[model samples]
Target: MGSLVASRPVYIPLSPCPRLPAPCSSWYSCSPYCLLQILVTFENLAAWGRCLCAVCPSPTTIVTSGASAVVCVWELGMAKGRPRGLHLKQALYGHTQAVTCLAASVTFSLLGTIVSCAGAHLSLWNVNGQSLASITTAWGPEGAITCCCVIEGPAWDTSHVIITGSQDGMVRVSVSWAE
Candidate 1:
């Protein structure tokens, strides 16, 4: 259930580990590809919360969400010629419950969407961090959603599809297009 994005900007879901000066953990050794972008601490995000889900949209950035009920955009920067770490580039808010799943639109090069699942609802955020829209996973109860994916829309069809699944064994597919 827990996995990192296999893309350029690898993302690791983590909770702040005390004792060590850094994000603390032995698992970091398994992932030698990513330079480890930890949110040691930030402005008002004292309760940064645990990272439940993440997706890398760009080579230098990753989108993460969890118990904080908000989406965070992190950018990797270099220091002294070494990969420094992540900088809080931006934050997207609106979901009331903890977001558990995230998916990036393939059309993101055109300012694509990032779909996040909180409870039984899905919230769409633009690559620019703007909250676009929110929708219920299904008309009938299907329990809390566990995962989601955004299928890119074809050239002939301007509508993309969002697929969501839950612990209750229900999968819902919905079509969405930019207006």
Candidate 2:
């Protein structure tokens, strides 16, 4: 009989101050302002990486999911030394399932909203992670929502509407709320 060999899992601790070592230019020690900017940039990069890993639903989609089927937003942009822009901001978690769609109010940029479909029910949330409203369609008959989009009018009379397409070959339009 052959003896069974057991192996225990090994855990490695991540470095607290993990930084890429690059050749220090003359500007590194010469300019105080440059050094400050470098430090700030590094800090932002670290925070951004952590936030991305924490919030993103999947590697492809850089959005995070929350309770009640909500996902938070991150303001991502380009940074110096980086080839592409990066995302920066706080994580918004408030969804119960993977976020199906996201839309920002055109009338008011600050009024960003997210929609997540749970069966035949759809949830609406504001930028601050609050549940502004929810709509439930006819159970089973309505089918699962496949897509959603938000349309806005002029600022004088703004409206928040969610247009959803379901698998049951029905397209439904519901007013999320009025600004």
Candidate 3:
């Protein structure tokens, strides 16, 4: 990738921390190299459902963040401190655990297709913020799903596929059952 364009330290105060005085566990930048999307988790708190992970589907106008099964969508311009309207456009809830990763396909047409992984579960959501399909793995020594990506099908096909990696070192591929 090109040299870093700008580097700034953003400090989210501990006031939002469910447990006062505890430092945030981790944070990830959802913004793509070209586009700036701001979606970050403050801490690893399971109480009050604060921990989260996020990703941008395409480098377009929509920025999505996933936390505790709730997906928050924001406009691209909002990242620049613009207050034209409510930055948060939608909040989708379905996943049973803190979303560990998200992948939005470039083909987010009117269908609004996106994939998210949490714990051992993978979920597919539509543009209308509806859960199209989801798969949950059983409890085992194998670990939770930790990462995900979208795979566009052939040009002739409209449906997309999802690939996810688990803490157990296994990668799984899944297609939308609603399609």
Colliding pairs, model 3: 57-104
Cα TM-score of candidate 2: 0.51
Error of 3 at 171 (Å): 1.0
Report the C-alpha lDDT of model 2 over 19-76, residue by residue, as the tens digit: 4243322333322122222212212333222322123322222343323343435543
Q: Write the per-residue lDDT of candidate 1 for residues 1-179, one digit (tens) a residue.
A: 12223334446655554544554443454332335554233233345577888898766667889998888878766566544457788788888889999998764665478899888889987778877789876544457898999887665565668888987899888888777
Write candidate 3's Cα lDDT for 76-148 as tens digits. Answer: 4334653223245567778765677888877666755777777787778887778888778546537688788
Compute each candidate's TM-score over C-alphas.
Answer: 0.67, 0.51, 0.62
**Cα misplacement distance, residue 134 of candidate 2 (Å):** 1.4
Model 1: ten consecutive residues of lowest lDDT:
1-10
Error of 3 at 156 (Å): 4.1
With candidate 2 superimposed using the best TM-score fit, by how many Å does residue 63's alpha carbon deviate from the native?
A: 4.5
The local distance difference test score of each candidate is 0.73, 0.49, 0.61
On TM-score, who's better, 1 or 3?
Answer: 1
Q: Which candidate's TM-score is highest?
A: 1
